[model samples]
Target chain A: MPDNLQQALGASTNEPTASSKSNLKKLPGDLAMWFFILAELTVFAIFFIGFAIAENLNLVMFAEGKAQLHKVAGLINTIALITSSYFVAISLHSMRVRNDRQAVFRLILALVFAAVYIVIKLWEYESLFEQGIDIETNTFFTLYFLITAFHFMHILLGMVILVYMAKNAYQGKYNDSSSESEFSGFESGACYWHMVDLLWIILFPLIYVI
Target chain B: MMKFWQRYALSWGWLIILTMASVAIGQYFQYATLNSVLFIAIVMLIIALKGQQIVDVFMELKHAPSLWRNIMLSYVIVVPLIITLIYI
Candidate 1:
């Protein structure tokens, strides 16, 4: 897609016109973001149902199992994700303001949050397992491990993208693009980061509250 | 009035408020079983709305070529329902 918004308002951003950037078409970044989201949601749905089913058989045990989780750790992860989402927004906003340098900086901030999220999640999981609550022991841990393990994977992927975008900016690939390429890359990054944030949104309550 | 609403009243503002409200209600109804379920549902709803808003506004899919925007939105909406129908 050409970056000329005056022209692109009537055009599709999916059709990258720059021959040099044709490989971008193959990635289909937006659709891929949502596709991964759908798949993750499907996995979470199974975990949720399994949890409820186990609850039906043994509500008290499930409740006891849930109470064992660390609320402080969960809240910390929630704050980290929420802050990363903010950084994602700031990065996108900086791009709109034509500040590529600032955009890269904000993405690094998001990466920091993703790293903190991973560290806290692993620490929490280790502590929980030490308490003798394995995923196979019951429904609570079953849902907990599946949801968090998948989210940990996403944090890893987002960190990779952040690093890639940072390197691309260093090389000036994203800086000189037509308005469309810049906007497209920035928006796609936000789309992916937001997907990460959205997963944690649902995961937080699943593991923490309900 | 509408422009003001669109700016200050961006959907996420309302969503954050709704999130806070849900948390408050969860605290008050601490032991209510169905409310716990509702709490999670509300959180999911906010996240869904936020995702759609990002795609629609920042991605500019809202004003994109109809074929792309419609189909994309359709998948976004349908995927969640299909997940629920098949699992939850």
Candidate 2:
């Protein structure tokens, strides 16, 4: 099998022979993480559909609203989130290879990149507020604030989870040899963080570009 | 023939390039042309692909069960396609 497929299979060659074989059918991360991911995605999908319909109703206003948005800031945030997601993935990969110290390091790196995203986002929001574009300004501004603010809350939550996971890793709570449930913190946190990134990928284009 | 970071780096590289491309296209349509279906269609395509990259690689859904993977893949493709058709 290809290397990425093998990694995606949650297989690291260093695992003991028994666990390596057994892990093949197991999904990465806690089962509860999948449930949360599904719920989060569903809510975002509804919001996205709602935005689409609203934009169709008021195309000119939506276009003008999008024009007021700082596309360069959105673009910068996109890169930051994407880079943070990359670090999060690598952090999880480090744990799977049983490098708990390295995992902690990578998780901190992820948090730093996520912080960059938050700073840029807040700057963008401040610019909008200075321009007198608040949530009650119009339908387009309303949806933009509602959706992006909701997504911003998720990013904050993900950061908290990452911090807790990093603490756990510091205490050596996770390793590839550990039981799946014991490793839930790392996987669950990483999954939620990625969901945030996933939502932003669509959100960026929908509100800022499209 | 590749290390793990190399594969991830490739994904990141693609993401950055596509992001810049989408922004440029967005600007072109905004300032130069109005009511262009092709521009909306192109932006929609980029959105779907970016969503796919996040689900498949960042989330590692590619190795997930077919049911899980297909569910996400459908969202990435269908949602933007619908919006594009309606708006464009």
Which candidate gets the maximum lDDT versus the true structure?
Answer: 2
lDDT (Cα, tens digit) per residue for candidate 1, span A13-71: 32234552432322223455556656765665566556556656776876787788886
- CA shift of B55, model 2, Å: 1.6
The residue pairs in collision within model 2 are: none
- Shift in Å, residue B80, candidate 1: 8.7
User: Which stretches of model 2 miss by more than 4 angstroms?
Assistant: A1-10, A14-25, A176-179
In the range B1-88, model 1's lDDT, one tens digit per residue, is 2331243236445445544554555556566556444454554455456546545653445545566556545544554343333323
The 0-to-1 C-alpha lDDT of every candidate, in the order given, reads 0.60, 0.82
**Which digits, one per residue and each the tens of the lDDT, describe model 2 over residues A1-210?**
132234434545433255555445445576777888888988998899899899999989998998898988888899999999999988887877778899899889989989998999999999989988899999999999999999999999999999998998888766434444557557668878988998898899889887
lDDT of 2: 0.82
Ten contiguous residues with the weakest lDDT in model 2 chain A: A1-10
- Number of the top candidate by DockQ? 2
User: Largest TM-score belongs to which candidate?
Assistant: 2
What's the true lDDT of residue A17 in model 2? 53
